[model samples]
Each structure stands twice: as C-alpha cells, then as structure tokens.
Target chain A: MAIEVRVPTILRSYTGGAKVVEGSGDTLSGLIDDLDAKHNGLKGRLITPEGGLHRFVNIYLNDEDVRFLGALDAKVADGDSITILPAVAGGALGFAAAAALLGR
Target chain B: MTPGVPAVGTATPGRAKSHGNVRHVLTIDSAILDAIVAHARRDHPDEACGVVAGPAGSDLPTRLIPMDNAARSMTFYEFDSIEQLRVWREMDDNDEEPVIIYHSHTATEAYPSRTDISFAGEPGAHYLLVSTREPDSTEIRSFRIVDNVVTEEEVNIVDATVDA
Candidate 1:
C-alpha cells in the first residue's frame, strides 16, 4: 500500500490546495521524489539543485525529525504518514521573541 | 509523518530566556543561518529548520541546535525546547551564545509573514529567513527585534555550511 503525504496550509498552493497526497515508496526520500515527478512546480518549490532539504522546508516521518535521521534518504514504509513543514518568522514582538531564542 | 515531512511547526524559534546576568544578549551568526537556509533550500522537496546556539560576550562561538521542524509545510517552525536544553548544555560546556532562530520560505520571498512577526518571542535575537522562489535568487534575510521593534540585518553567507 502507498503511504499518504500531508501538506501544511502554507504550501497548499503548490499541491493545488490539497493538504494530502498519495505516493509509493519504502523511504521518505523516495516518496518525495515520486511526488515531485508528478508535480514539477512542487519540485521547483521544494528541492534545490544540490539535492539537500530546503532550509525553510521541514519534513517529518511519523513525528520524528528526518534531519536527525538519514535526511531525505530516510526510509519509510507502507501506510507511513509524511508531513511537510516550513519555518516562518514575523510578528510585533517578533524581534524580541527571536532574540529570546538566541542563547549563550 | 512527524519528521518525514518538513512542516512549519518545526521551525526552531531560537530563543534563550534572559539569564539576568548583566542583561547579556544571545545570538547565532549569519554563517549558521546560512547553513540552515542552504539546508532548507537543498531539501526544497521538503522543508527544513533548526536551532543554532552559542554564547554572548565580547566573543561568540556559534553552535547548531538540531531540533524538530514542526510546521509541516506551512512556512513556519516550532523547535523542540526539550531538545534545545541538550543543545544548551553543549554550548555551556564550550562557553558560547545561542543567538539565532531561522527558517525559510520555499517558492516565496525572504520576508516576514504576519505569523512570523506575531510569534516573535525573544527580543534582540536575529530572525533569519530563507526563500527559494527564484532559482538564481539569493533567498536569505535576517532581522532583529527589541521592545516590539523589528530590525533586519545583512546575512553573511560564508560558505555552504558557513553560508547556511
């Protein structure tokens, strides 16, 4: 069975506003490649020519971080759930909050 | 997939609570943010975000705090504070300041969204943005906030990791 891919609200436009997608693969990276093949715009939006995960974009496999794992090469299984996340910043006290995150 | 898909929630809101010692400032260098932006861009098929730590004083040493990218493709990041604690220890051991929280915008420009501004927690910290809308465009920008004021800074892309 193919695993289901979920797109977050911000990236809905790339997927034609569909929050969920379907694909077949044994690893997270494989599944994304398959999806990208079907969606060129998604490929442009997601992948850089260097083949590394986008800094602004984040990926999760069953709630575990792919970066700590094997990155895009991380393996997946049937019925696995994939999610795409992008990092954003901006607010009134946004600058203060961002500073708080910076530590010593 | 929590970690499989790069989501918005995982963008580490890199904030370090004020230790109240001489009102010191925390920070992460442009090189570190460059590394993060590069990583996100490289992984554009997915989203990427994380925490970069170090110490503040006359001198600073930047450290990478590998946390969760929780936004799930929503152009945001919610870093794991628990994981951040561990990174804090590492910086403590090395005497550095964790001064930066950064994220990127795939297929968009490197500018702050309403949410990005509203979620600002730490004051005087650098807010780094990485955008990948244009293939040949330099999609990275930095910001600083204090007392509800936002200030943008020039990010220095040193090298691949340095540039990120």
Candidate 2:
C-alpha cells in the first residue's frame, strides 16, 4: 500500500529535505510507525509521550482531519494522502493560564 | 473566503538593518497595515489572527487572509485547524507562502508573549503583533521568532498611493 505523506517544511529534516515520502499501513497509526522506521524520530514529533496526538501537530488524511476521524485509529487505504502541518497557535497569555482557561 | 486585494504595483523592499543572522525589517503596504489594525479593534477583548500571503520566495505581503481564532480567548489565538488546512492548501495551489502571520493582544503591548514564542511554527514568516489595549491608539510591531528566540524587526509601511 503506497500512501503519499506530505511533510511540512519544519519537519523536512527527518525526510532528508524531501517534501513527499511514501509509507504503507492500514491505519494512520500504523502508517506513522512505518514512516518513523524509514524517517527516524518522525513519530515522536507527531505523537506525544502519553500516546496521544500532539495538540500542536495536525494530520489530515485526504482532506479530512484525522482527529475527526477517530484520530490515530483512523483507517487509511492505498493511494490515500496524508498532510502534516504544525499547528499555528499562541497568545499573550501564559501556558498555565491558557491551560486553566481550557479547563485541562 | 477572505477578500483578495487587487494586484498593485510591487513596492520596493524595506531597508533591513543587519542583526547578525537576522534581517530586521518588514516592508508592508499601508492599507494592509490599516486592515490589520481594524481587524484587531473589531475583535477586541478576543484575539484576532490572520496570514498575509505573497509569492513564494518573494517575501512581499499582498494577500490578507484573516483566520478564525479557534481558541477565542482574550490572551490567546489559535487558527482553526480545518480552516488552516484549507488556507494552506490554497496557498500551495497559488504558489504563494505566508509572508506575515499576525495576531492581536487586547490587554498587552504589541509584543510576543512566552506562549507566542513557544507555539510559533513558521520560521520564514514575520510574526506581526497588534495591541488594541488603548481605545484611542493601537501599536503594531513585527518580529522574527525562530529557535525559541524573538528578534524585533522594523516595520516599513509603504503608502497606499505609492503602491497604486
């Protein structure tokens, strides 16, 4: 299953500066694992130590955000494309206050 | 969809002061600056954010795409994920890149806070800030934030007449 993965500029170092790379898997999680095997340390940037999708990293599968598609368990098929973008977020508030405001 | 500005004559690049490896200057259109300040005031109390896209590698800001601040908090701004995806794809299709990524601070100065530094992901774009704290006055500033370091840059606003 050849899935084309689009890498954002910030994460291009892991792909040897290549913008697009290929991987194989039936699910997004498996695909990432396969990608990490070839790219090395790419998974650590996408997934958190707690085993959840990083809030600051966005993954889309064929125009649908993976978060809305059962996140890591989202199914992927051959020819599907994955686009990863670092979330653009920030503010004047501190992380503690923002976290409290988020009730997390 | 954010409105597209007419393709005006290209303005000369601003004179950047050398600061080691940082180029400390952002040459922008005056009308675009006004639009940014207007958006900040309009969304006062809640932060407003947007991106200004230009030709890839041009570094000249020509398109103003105001993004929805999904967080909608007075002290924070986050581009809605889905909208961001669409906008990014649009840029890619048009052979454009984000030249300026801007946001407003309702209660603080036009400067990046710690959180802003932490979440800044675009190394190639200027991080513009607008302060709407004063009812009668607004402060606009620009910066280059890379590798967890923030360096203030001079904003050179070209008059609308010159561009038209």
Candidate 3:
C-alpha cells in the first residue's frame, strides 16, 4: 500500500526541505524502513533497535497514532498518511516578549 | 500562560527557578494536549488555543483554559495578556494556578522541541505539549528554566480531567 508521510518543519531538513513525502509500506514499520533507506539519519531518529519507536516520536497511521493500536508494527492500509511527530516543549512566545517589554 | 507547575519553585533556596528554564519540568501524557492540538489543527494552525480551569476545592474537575490561538504558529504561542491575566486573576480568585501552558506539535510529538525550549522561559511554568499527528497518545512534560537550564520532571495524569 502507498502512504504519505508528513514531516514536521524541524525534520524537513532530512527530506531535502520537503514537507510532505510519499512512499509505499504495507505496515507502519515498512513505511519507516522505506523512508530511512531514502533519508539519512531519519531511521535512528524515528525507530529504535528494539523495533519500538523512539520515546519522543509518535507515528500516526491515517490520523491515528499506531501506539494506541499496537505500535510500530501496526498494519497500514493503502493511502495512509503516517505523520512523524517529534516531541516539542512549551511555546513561550508571549512570556518572553513580555519579559523583553519589561526590559528583562 | 504557562501552567502545571508548583509555585513552590521560588519558595525554597537553590530550588528557586529562574526564567527561560525549560529543563526543570514534569512530564505527563499527551492525551489532554491532543485536544488542544486538534483544536489548532482544525480551525487555524496559526491561532487556536484555550485555557484550563479547576475548582477551588479538590472535589472539582480541572477545566481547560481554551483561548483563541490568534498568534502566528511560528514555534511560540501568543495569547491575549489581558485575557491571560484575567484567567490567572480569576484563578487567584479561585486560589489555583492554571498549572499548564500548552501548544501543538502539528506535525510532531508531545515533547519539548528546540523551538519550544528556546521560547520556554517562564519561571514556574511547566511546559505542556500537544502533538497533532499523534492523537490521544500524547506526552506532557514539566520544566523549569532557571538561568537557561531546563530541569524536567514527570507529572502523573491519573485522569484526563486532572493532573497530579
């Protein structure tokens, strides 16, 4: 089955700065394996040697996180969009700007 | 408005936190965070947010401070300060802090990303992350940015309604 992988803005560097990537994978693991074969450093970042996904990454198959199902090995259907999400912290824009306004 | 942190940061010596510290944090599941992320993904990826509120006593349920995500989705979140102040003031009126400041990782997981750490600088604010790509299976971690050092901790989310 063919799936489209959506990359976050941060990891876009690995995909030649492309936001969206299309590939084929019957299962979620197959999809990632195919992606890593083409993209450098993405495999280490997404999947661990144990075959489980990295702690900071969440793999969504067709808008649903595979972890909620059975995780990395979760099966995928055709036209699935597996989104790889890197864990990010708080977005403290206003606080910083406020501090700056306060001259801190 | 950063929340999910104990005001106890400054109540002690050495333990007191400084601003911009995203490391002194506690982590929680990202299920609740997903609600916020989904909200942002639905209407405006740029500006779609909310507020969280709880009762004055323990018996009440913790509520979300859902607000308008009107700021540019450029790594950081922007809210109406007056509205935030009002929420906090109301919290003060209720005798509880918001306890969580959250935003979405539209294409990422529910962890503190570089941009999130760069922007995270609240003294007693615990950073909460919502991953849009991974719904329900989210991660929430708390942090304290003290003089540029980010300290993290784990916050057990017993129920999707309240934080521990």
In model 2, pairs of residues that clash are none
**lDDT, candidate 2, B9-92, per-residue tens:** 323243232211125678888899999999999999999999999888777888999999998889888888899999999999
| Stretches of candidate 2 exceeding 4 Å from the true structure | A99-104, B1-22, B160-164
Assess candidate 2 and give its TM-score to the true structure.
Answer: 0.88
Name the lDDT value of residue B38 in candidate 2: 92
Worst lDDT run of 10 residues, candidate 1 chain A, spans: A87-96
Per residue, candidate 3 scores C-alpha lDDT tens digits across B76-163 of: 4555434544554576677764445666655555556554565443334555555555444544454554445666664544334334
Instruction: Show the lowest summed lDDT stretch of 10 residues, model 1 chain B.
Output: B16-25
DockQ of 3: 0.09
Each prediction's RMSD to truth: 17.4, 7.1, 19.4
The sequence of per-residue lDDT tens digits that candidate 1 reaches over residues A1-104 is 77887675455766787868888787666777788777656765556677776544556776666877787788888888776654333322244444354320
Ranking by TM-score: 2, 1, 3
Task: Please identify which of the two predictions, 2 or 3, would achieve the higher DockQ against the true structure.
Answer: 2
Please provide, for model 3 over A2-102, each residue's C-alpha lDDT reduced to its tens digit, 9 standing for 90 to 100.
Answer: 68887754567789989688877777778778888888788787776776676445566765557676876788777777766543223534445533432
